[model samples]
Structure formats: structure tokens, C-alpha cells
Target chain A: MTKFANILVPVDFGAPSRRGLELAVDLARRNGARLTLLHVFDVPVSYAGMGLSPTELLAPMWDAEQEELDRVLAKVRDEIPEVSRETARGVPWREILAFIEQRRPDLVVMGTHGRHGVPRALLGSVAEKIVRLSPCPVLTVRAEDEA
Target chain B: MKRILAAVDLTSTAHLIIRHAVELARSMGGRVRLLHSVVIAPQVPPPGVFVPLTSFRAHELADAARTAMESLEESIPRELRDGVVVEIGHAADCVCEAARAYDADVVVIGAHDYGLISRALGTTAARIVNRMDRPVFVVRPMPTSHVVEPEPVSAKAG
Candidate 1:
């Protein structure tokens, strides 16, 4: 039998990720699967010599990022009406995979830009990376195709 | 009508792609072909005096594929069953070759998230999409609850 007990959607507070979220929510609502909305707080980094205290430099960023995530979750709840949301701290890809392994989610819905070249190489696409390592099935909604 | 090919492998996710293709075919009114490629058994080494010779077999593997299709038969809505097609070969090549031979309009597949290694090596769906000349829809299997079972739009007359 087909099985999907939980669906994990990683959000970046962007249109692409938002689109993926909407799709996941509608799907979970229809299928009666619990939807977990996640936003990761990437660890802070500061240059060595031109230093400020770690907390002084990083605390504000963490607060601001958390605030933004809270707003995003609120907005998703308002629009979709049914889903669970939480925030976490770590590298996006690693955290996403950890959640998958811990939760053993049946599916992961992600969005991609289908990037190529130097910019893609530098930033490293999360969706692409997640697709590569996720043990479960991943649905990558392309931004260009959505339009 | 242009043929639409849905490639099925032994993976659990393959059914999701098949269902998606059936839905698309119902909407587009096209012929659908379901192809499952059974890999020919690998060659066995020659027998040593102390050991029995090994024989490679293909039929047993093909039977497994057929059984899987049969188990999933009822899950496929009735309207789409008439066009179901099943064959076996190495996953990537068979999917591409069948698409070509059938002159399919679109090819649908389901991809498991294989992580970093598969990305570098390219997953089967990615390989097929890149190497083949057809649009490939790689759907992530929706959680069973999320899988929308299309309600019949028209009611039967009494």
C-alpha cells in the first residue's frame, strides 16, 4: 500500500520554497498527512582579525532570522490553515536531512532554480543537494516551470 | 495520438509516476505505455571441479516484475488499465529506448532522493531526462494521505 505518514517541507521565505509549501500543504490536507514546516537558522560566521564579540555580532542576526521565520510560519498557517511549524539552527542541507532521518518522513517537497555556473557553485543549491542525499522521495518543483 | 511512456522499476516510488502518467493521459487523451525493463541475469562463472556450474536466468526476474504489475493492477483506475505496458531492461536504457521506439510525447518517472552521490552520478530520472528527447515528469510520491484519489465527476444514472 502507498504510505506517507509525514511530509516535510523546508522553507526559505522565498517564492520558490513558498510554492513548494503550498503544494505540500494542499497535498497533506487532502491526504490527511501531518505537514511539518521548517526554517533553518544557519550558524553565524565572522572574519578573524576585524572582530567583534561572537554574541554581539551574531545575536542580532539570530533574533532577526527567528522573527522572519515566525512571520513566515504565521503566514503559512493563515493561508493553509493546517500544518505544524518549527525553527532550527544549522546548515540547511544537513538539518533538513537530520529531520528526515529522525522523523522518517515519507516525502520531502522542495523547490529548485535549476542553477548552473559560478553563482550556483558558490552558494550551492539546497534543493539540488537535498535531492542528492535524502533517503526518502523528494519532489523538486522548478521555479521557472511553475510560472 | 502521441504515445506517453511511464517507466516502472522495482522501486516503491515507481507507482507514483505511473499514477501521474495515467492522470495525464486521461486529461490529454493519449495512448499510454507502461514499460518495466528486467535486467538480463548477469553471466555466471564457469564451474570448478569442486563446484557446480552456475546458470544465469532472466525469466524469474521478469516474473517478479509481472507480479508487481499485477498487484498494482487494481490500484490503477479502470480507464487507464487498457493501455498498461510492461517490459524489462536496465532501468535507464530501457526507459529511453522505449520512449524512442514508441515516439512518446512525454515520459513520467519517480525519483528517490539519493543525496550527493546520485547528484554527481545523476539519478535515473535525471539521466533519462538529459539523454532522452522527451519531457520527463519526476514526481515525488505524495504521502498516501496526500495522494488525491480523483472522485468520479459523473454519477451513474439509476
Candidate 2:
């Protein structure tokens, strides 16, 4: 029997990700695992060419982002009081993998939009990439199927 | 959660995958059904070669898969073992169908690090995740030892 002590959940705040958060909270309660909610901020490519230093442009955004994350955390804290929060800036998938490498969570619970075919090819999915590359187990919860 | 469908390939990681499912089931008061899918390749004979190869190979492969699945069923923990399902079809499709049939709350599977080709074409776990409506728990093979280290953070705000 494997016991998970640390669980990581990445949120984009979409419906699917919110569902993942719900599942993560349940799992954390069941396993007595520490839960960390991570939100990765991807810098737009347009910002790189805006002439202004990316850091200067992103400083205020980081403050707003942290505040938004805290707001989201407040909603769930009652269900999962001890849950931790993390914010990173980079490619979403790469930051997730790096976090997994750093924290070595026993399991990662995340959401997938369930995109398929050409769109999935063109816009690669972060959840798919993490599932492919994460060193730990990944449990993916998709939005409820309409069909 | 009454049932957990564990999709395995009879690989070395199969036992670990089953164990994970069983342990979760034990904790949650559910049972596990081990599922194995036998993928039958299309045997295309040359234009003039009317060889009866396709059916023969499919039969042989399906038989072998059944034997392996039966052995795997025997090895499941007595309390958690609900039943075993051996199906003939695409792995992802079979898993989803079995989940529907068994009314499984979750689908547990093992993923192999198939390197670049799998990365491009997608692995079984990826396909199942995309196709199945149920939650999918993909367990990667465990490392030989536990080693934890903090990774250098790569956040750049400038």
C-alpha cells in the first residue's frame, strides 16, 4: 500500500481545474496529505518585444496574481485549511514539471480540458505534458462529458 | 466508490498498478477489476498471397492474453479482487467500455516512459485520459530509490 504525504494541484481556475481542486481536497483529507495549490503565470510573447523590461512590466501583474490566488485560496481554505499556495512565472508545463522535481510530491492532481485531434496538436495540453513527463503519479480529472 | 478498474498490460509494472488500485479501494471501501486488452494487429497479406494469417495470429494473441489475465486475477488480493476482464480491442477504448460496464468510480493505469516516439504519438495513458469520462489515475513506475532535492526556481519577472 502506497501512502501519499504530499499532493500537488495546479489550477488555471477553469471549471475542470476547479473540479480537480475538489478531488484534491477530498484526497488530501482521506490520506492526510499536504496539499499545495500552484498557479503558473505565462508571460505573453508580445510582452517580450514591448521594449520595456519584462520584469518591470510583470511586477504589478505578479502582485495582482498573488492577490487573485489568495482570493481563490480563501474559498477553499474552509474545506482544506492547511493547504499551501505557490506562484510561478514560466511556460505552464515546464514550471509544473520543475515544481514536481523540486517538491517531489507523491501525486499530482490536475485537470484536462479533453481537447482532441488537430487543436490538441496545435495547442499542446499542459496536463498531457505533465502526465507524460512528471516523475510522480498524475491523476487527471476532465470536465464532465456532454455526450 | 464501489469499483475500480485497473487497466494493465501484463508488464512488470502491472503488479504495482494493481497494488495502487487495490490499496485505494481498500481505503475507500471499493473493489478492483483488473482489465487487460489484447491489441490484434491487422494482418495484410500481399496481393497474390492468400494466406490465412490474420485470424490465426489474432486467435493466438488473444489466447495468450487470456492466460496472462487469468494468472493476474489469481494474484490479486482476495478481498479487493472483484473480477478480471480480458478484452480484444484498442487499449483505451477497452478501458473506457469496461469502466462503463463495471460502473467503476475511477480508472487506474500504469504508464511506461516510451521516450520520444511515445511523446509524439501519445501513450496509452494519454489516450485513455482524453477518451474516458471517468477520472484516470496514471501511476508511473517507481524509481529504485527515493531522492528528493529542491530544483532551482526559474521565475523571471523582469
Candidate 3:
């Protein structure tokens, strides 16, 4: 049987993401795979158009996001000790794909909102995009419609 | 208990997909059902070709697909193979239908990262995840080197 050595879970601190984290923890513990919790901070490009330097304007936002991430990481660590955490700044899907390429985790466990119809077509999902482009397989856990 | 439905394309990654489903079923004290869909391409005769009327090719293809699915079922360890299903239609639709028909707890599938053209069109696994209400576990074939030998501890640590 192929055992997973590393499992990557991207967290957005949403309920769906929390469900994904829970599933990742279960799979990691079962396979003795190392878990890496990732959070991406996407800086809006519009800030660059403004007079303010994007980095300078986003400094406070980054700090707050990092603080929240740290809190989440601490909570997750309590459940799965020795789990690693990563934070990236860029487009959410692009950063995630880059991380997957660099780390080469056996599996990526993430959450999806499970949207459909016009709304989904209008606003594409990050989870869907990652599933489409990630270097490795992605197990998507939907927020609702659990069967 | 979990009832895993493994949807495979019978490609090189089919075995991996079944393996993952079997392992998960074993760990969860569940059962596994293997499903394969035969996508019947629209038989479009060439613009200037004289084609003889023949039996429905889709039926013939479905029969061949059923045989192949049965062979695949035989390849699986008897203990792990609970059921095998071969359906004819779009891969995504068939998988979703099987899941509903079998009351699958989760749907396991293999995904191939196709080129930009196919990516734009979307893959069956993606379609399954979008349509099925059940959880979908998509497995991509890992490089043999990575699976055969564990990475350095330091590499993972960092």
C-alpha cells in the first residue's frame, strides 16, 4: 500500500477549511504523514495603483493576518503535534501551486464551498482552481452536503 | 462504515486509484465498489465516406468495457473487491450515477493534469467533485522514486 508521507492542508479559517483540516489530521495520523498547514495572504493589486506603496499599505493587514494564522496554527498544533505551518503572500491559487511544486506533498486536502449554477460560474472557487492545477492530488471536502 | 466507490479510467493510474480506495476501506472498516465508464464517442462518418449500416457501436463498446471492468475486478484481491460496475455514457455522469445508485460514502477518483486545452475543458474528476454531493478523493500518481524511498527528514522538517 502506498502511504502518504506528507499531507498539505490549506486553511482559510472558514468552516469548510476547518472540515478539511480535520480530515487531513485524520489521514495524517493514520498514515504517519507530516501535516503542513498553509495560509496565503493575497494583497489586492489595486493598492499598487494607489499612491501608497503596496507593501507599506499591506503591512498592517499582513501583521493581523499573521497573528490570526499563528493562533490557528497553535490550535492545530495542539491536535497534531510537530505539524509544520507556512504563510505566503501572493495570489491564493498561484502561491498554493508554487508551494505544491516546491514541497511535492503526496496529497493536498482542502475545502470547497460546493457552489454551482450562475454564482459559481461568476465567482470561480480557489479550491476548484487548485484542484485543476495543483501538482499533486487534492481531496476536496465540501462545507455542506456531507454524505 | 464507509462505502467507497472508486471511479477509474483504466489508465496506468487505475491501479493506484483502486489501491487508495482499498486502503481507505480497510482502514475505515468499509467496502469498496469499482466503477468504470465507457465514453462512447459520437460515431461521425466522414463527410464523403460510404458507411455500412451496422449494429450500434455504442452497445459493442459497452460490452467490451464490461469485459475489461470484469478483468480489472479479477485483478483486485478477492477480499478487497466487493463490487464492479461498468456503465456507458459520460464519465462524470456515470460516476455520479453510480455513487447515488450504490449509496457510496465517498467517491475516489484519479486525476491527470492534462494540457491547457483539456484543462480549459475540465477533467472528469473535476466534474465529479462539482456534481457529486459525497466527498471526492482525487489521487494523482506520485513518481515512483518518491514513493519507493522516503525523503530526508530535514527536507520535510523545513
Candidate 4:
């Protein structure tokens, strides 16, 4: 069997994202692969003009974000013993691409809003960009369609 | 994980796309159904005009697609390919329809290198991922290291 050794799953605390996480866990467990749960957070670039330093604005949220990342990965800890958590600070897709380059995960499983979800708030089209640019394969899981 | 619907084009890169589906089925214990969507323009006549041969193009393309897919099967793993379907319609729409018909757990489609317009106008894989009711595994075309004979101009199937 061809091994998907390193799998990366990006979460944004969305309902669809939860589905992506669970599926990633299934793949990791089946392949005995290492899984990385990633959450990218950066204080808005627009916030810089408000006289608040990036460090000051990011300080409190950093712990909270890491906590969320930890919590997300914790759900799979029992199933995937080798899973790890990653939180990056930048634009979501850019940070993800950099992470992919740094650690070339064989597969990336992430939640996507598809076309209608692209214009949704927060991670707008992040999955779209990742799917287009990632050097490896991407498995995009959408929430169950209401149709 | 039990069933995968793999959508492929007539290009050589489809061999690589089918391999991805095979590996996934091997790793997760599933069977794969191969599908090819033939791209035929819809011939909608002006309301007052009676258009002859309206369905002709569709039938012709579907037949060509079936032949092309048969050639593709010879290059892919036969055992894992449990079923083959040749659909005539938009690639993205056909893929989602096939996924529903197959009751596939995931849809595996080949993604191409980005064109300038792809971001604005989504790729078929992107469209299916959004509108589809299931997970999608998208494989990008990679430049092969070794030189092989280029595939002949392929049937307009994806």
C-alpha cells in the first residue's frame, strides 16, 4: 500500500471543519501516519493602524488559539497517538502553503465551503487556494449538503 | 472509505489520478468506480427554430468517451476498478451525479495546474468540491521525471 505518511488537516473551528478532522483521524489511524492539526491565526493587518502593536494584540489571543488547537487535536489523540498541533500567524492559505513547504506532508485533508461557502466569512476560499497550489494531494470535505 | 468515485480525463495524467484512487482504496479498504465526463456543448436552438441533430453531439461524445475510458482501463489497476461510467455533460456536474449514483464515500478527481482564469472561474474539481454532497480527493498533475512518449491528442473527456 502506498503510504500517506504525514497528513495535515487545517481547522477553523467550523462545523464542516469538524468533519474534516474526523476523516483525517480515520486516515491517520488506518495508515499509522503522523497527523498535524493546524490553526492559523494572525491579528488582522487592519488592526495595525489602530495604534496597537501586533504583539500586544496577539498576546492574549495566542494562548486562546493554542488552546483551541489543542482541544481540536485532543479529540483525535486516542485514535492517533502521534498527532501534533500547529498554529501559524499569517494569512490562512499563505501560512498553510509555507507549512507545506517546510514539512511536505504527503496528504492534506481540510474542510472546504466549496463554491457557496467560498464567500462566507472568515476563511474565504482558503480550501480553494490550498487545492490549487498545494504540491501534494488535498482531500476537501464539505459539511453534509442540506439538499 | 468503502467506495470511491474517481473522475479522470483522457490525458495521460489520468493514469496518475487512477493510481491515487487505487492507493486510497488500498490504504482504507474501498473499491473504486471510474468515470469520464465527456465535454459536449449544449445545443439549445432559439425557441422558434427547430434544431436538427440536437442530441447527436451528445451521443457521439458519449461513445467516444466510452472508448477513451476503455483505453484508460488497460493502463489502470483492473481489480480495484469495479465499474466504469461514461457521462455526457459538464465535468463537474457529471461527477457529482455519478457520486450520488454510486453512493461513493469520496470523489477522487484530477486537478490541473492553475490557469489565470481558474481562480475566478473555478476548476471542475473545485466546482464539484463545493456543490458535491461528499468528500473530494483532488490530485494535481505532476511533471514526470522520466521522459515517456506523450499521449496522443486525447478525446475531449474529463
Segments in model 2 whose C-alpha atoms lie over 4 Å from true places = A53-57, A116-124, A145-147, B45-64, B114-122, B146-158
Worst 10 residues of 4 chain A by lDDT: A115-124
- Tell me the deviation in Å of residue A106 in model 1: 1.8
Candidate that beats the other on lDDT, 1 or 4, i.e. the better one: 4
Worst 10 residues of 2 chain B by lDDT: B149-158
Tens-digit per-residue lDDT, A1-147, candidate 4: 335888999888887778789889989998989999988896677787898776778787888888888877777898899999888888899999899868878899988654554432322378877877887788988765522
Compared with the true structure, what per-residue lDDT tens digits does model 2 show for residues A35-140? Answer: 8999999887788877997678998887788888898888878777778999888999999989998998988998777655433341137887888888787888
Q: For candidate 3, write residues B6-116 as lDDT tens digits.
A: 998878777677767766776566877889888766668989997654346667777887777777666555666678888878998999899999988778998774444
Chain A: TM-score in each model: 0.79, 0.85, 0.85, 0.86
List candidate 1 stretches off by more than 4 Å: A44-50, A115-124, A145-147, B1-6, B10-75, B79-122, B128-158
TM-score of chain A of 4: 0.86
Which whole-number lDDT from 0 to 100 does residue B39 have in model 1?
70
Evaluated against the true structure, the overall lDDT of model 2 is 0.77
lDDT (0-100) at residue B24 of candidate 3? Answer: 72
| lDDT, model 1, position B76 | 56
lDDT values of the candidates? Answer: 0.63, 0.77, 0.75, 0.76
TM-score for each model:
0.58, 0.82, 0.81, 0.82
TM-score of 2: 0.82
The TM-score measured for candidate 3 stands at 0.81
Clashes of each: 13, 3, 0, 1
